[model samples]
Each structure stands twice: as structure tokens, then as C-alpha cells.
Target: MKTFTSGWAFQKPDQNYFKKFIRLNNIAIDGIVYPKKILADIEGIPVLGFDDAHDIIQPDDLVLDVSTNPDLRKELEPFFAAKDIDCVSVPDYLDRLLSADQHDALLLPVAGIKASDIRKLKSAPIPDRFDAHFLDAESYEVASKLDGIFRHSQWQRLVEFDRDDPTGNVLFNVLLDLHARGLLKHLSA
Candidate 1:
């Protein structure tokens, strides 16, 4: 009965449909739609404002904080820690998940997973077209900061993050390789 409290992007309109869909599948998830920062339920797995989000997440839940502000983790970690919950900013989460020989992230599922012996959360979504939805000021800030990271990485060949990616797996994999080779800082830096 773990809840995947994803940090959703702003203005996502599928919360209602997603809540209904989860109810039909009996996944024990509540599609909490925050008016200030909408969360994505599908493969997009968008981000949301973490301040108010802690209220909705239950103990043992994992929150994906997508704010580009590096200080956000410092602020969130202690709060979630007090509540017995786990939290990770997007980049940090990916870096850890893709790390090898140094972490236990391999236990986590990549796309979908084997659930309840049969019902599966199949992996598929529209091409996301996230650039279209990233019209918010925060999105612009995140994009700008991450763009600087891409330009500054020592990956030998250019590593570009596809804003249109629905699942953000590109950034995750890149972060893993860069971190492994010691070519990048902690999280796709």
C-alpha cells in the first residue's frame, strides 16, 4: 500500500481521469491534485510543490521532488524524515537509482513492475511534449539551470536532455554514466 507521491508539473489536467483509473485498478493510490502544482500520474510523473505535498503523502511513501532549487532537499529531508517518509529530488533520485556497485537502487523497478501477481502498470504514454506544458516560471528556471549543467558536463560527446521525454529516463541514464565515470558531480552536474 505504498503511495508514489510524484512531484507533478503545473497545469496537468488528467488528475480526475487518473484518480478514476487507479480506483478501477485498486492500486491504493489517491490522485491528489494540488491547484498550485499539478502532479502527473501517468508515465510523465510530473512534479509538484513539496510544501503542501507532505500533507497528502503517507508514512513509508516516497516523494519525488522535482524542484530545480538545490536547497529544496535540505528543507524537505528533515521534514519527511520526521514523518518516517522518504524524499528525493528528481536528479538525485535518478543518480542513485542508476548507480551500480555502490548502492541498492537495483531493487527498484525501472518502468513498470510485477504487481499482485497479475495486474501490471504497463509502461506507455503519449510522447509527453513536455516543452508545451513547461510554460510556468518555475519550469523555465529548472530548464535554465539544467541546461547549464548539460553544457558543463565532461561526457566527451554532448549529452542532451530531451524535454519532450515523458519519463525523464534519458537524464537518469546520463546521470548514471556521468557519475560512474567521475565526469559529473553528484547528480548529472
Candidate 2:
């Protein structure tokens, strides 16, 4: 499930667009309006209080930061980062989802998301290296070399022979796909 917290930063967000975005992605998100100012009457999502949000949000939950205020960013960024909560601007999220076509829902909106409340646009950051949290050193070596990304189906088709590799052939398929995309080089036999 996705989670969000709307802060004092929001001026006039497109509530209707937000609703359609959630529905199109079928994201089961719980949101809260802090300072009790944002009176967005989201139909399915419940408006939670600060205390409720603190208790409910865990690691991986995203905190929406629509503010361009440096002071607000300084104060909030560390707090959320310490708690392992991801903070993202709504615009960035929408762009990534749309561009990647990563929506999990069967039905999607034909139109694009409108960012009426956004002040300054935030650009997506390119990763310098892969985070080897769940991967071993050997796996990390290959993963770290992946300088680009492609659709899984495209990669899968490139390695079509492994579809029946009973063991799932996950790492091999991924490595092979990266190699095919020219994202991996100097691979040892």
C-alpha cells in the first residue's frame, strides 16, 4: 500500500486529478493532512491526523513534499530520511509512473496528471551505484554495472530460453538482459 502526508506546502492541488491517479494506479494509500489545513475531501482515502500518520507510516512509505521552501526542506528531509521514509514531490511520482507505465491497475486514465499546485519542478536523480542491501557482492558487481534500464518483457524475450528454468532463473535473466541492453560490459564467462 502507498502512503502520503500533505503538509502546509500545498496551495491548491488538483484533488480530482489526485483521485483519478490513485484509482488508475489502484494504489491503496492512507493519507493525512497535517496542520489540519488541507481540507481535501478525498473519497476513498481517509484523512488521518498527525498522530495517526506517525503510527501508520512505516519504512518505504512516502512523504509528499510539495514545498520549495528551503527551511521546510531542511527540517523535514532529515526527519523522514532518518525514519527511512521516502519523500517525493507529486510531480516526480506522476512522471515516473506514467513514463514507466508501471501502474498496477487494470484500468488507467487516458489523460495526464495536472500539477496546478506545484511551484518548482523536481528532476529525477540518477543513481550513482546500486544499493547492495539484499544482494551478495557477486550479484552487486553485475547489478552495479547496469547503467540503463529496459522493460522486463523486452529483457525476458532476449533471454527466452530461460523461461522454463524451474529455479526461476531470476539473476541470470537479469544479468543477461542487462548485457543485451549494453548496460553490462566486461562480463566474465
The alpha-carbon lDDT assigned to residue 66 of candidate 2 equals 51
Compose the digit string of candidate 2's lDDT tens values, residues 44-76: 456655456667777776666654557656755
TM-score of each: 0.28, 0.40
Per lDDT, the best of the predicted structures is 2
Cα miss at 35, model 2 (Å)?
A: 4.4
Local distance difference test scores for all models: 0.43, 0.49
List ranges where model 2 is wrong by over 4 Å: 8-15, 33-42, 66-82, 102-189
TM-score, cand. 2: 0.40
For model 1, where is the 10-residue window of minimal lDDT? 113-122
Q: Which pairs of residues have clashing backbones in candidate 1? A: 7-46, 7-47, 7-48, 8-39, 8-46, 8-47, 8-48, 9-47
- List residue ranges in candidate 1 displaced over 4 A: 2-55, 88-189
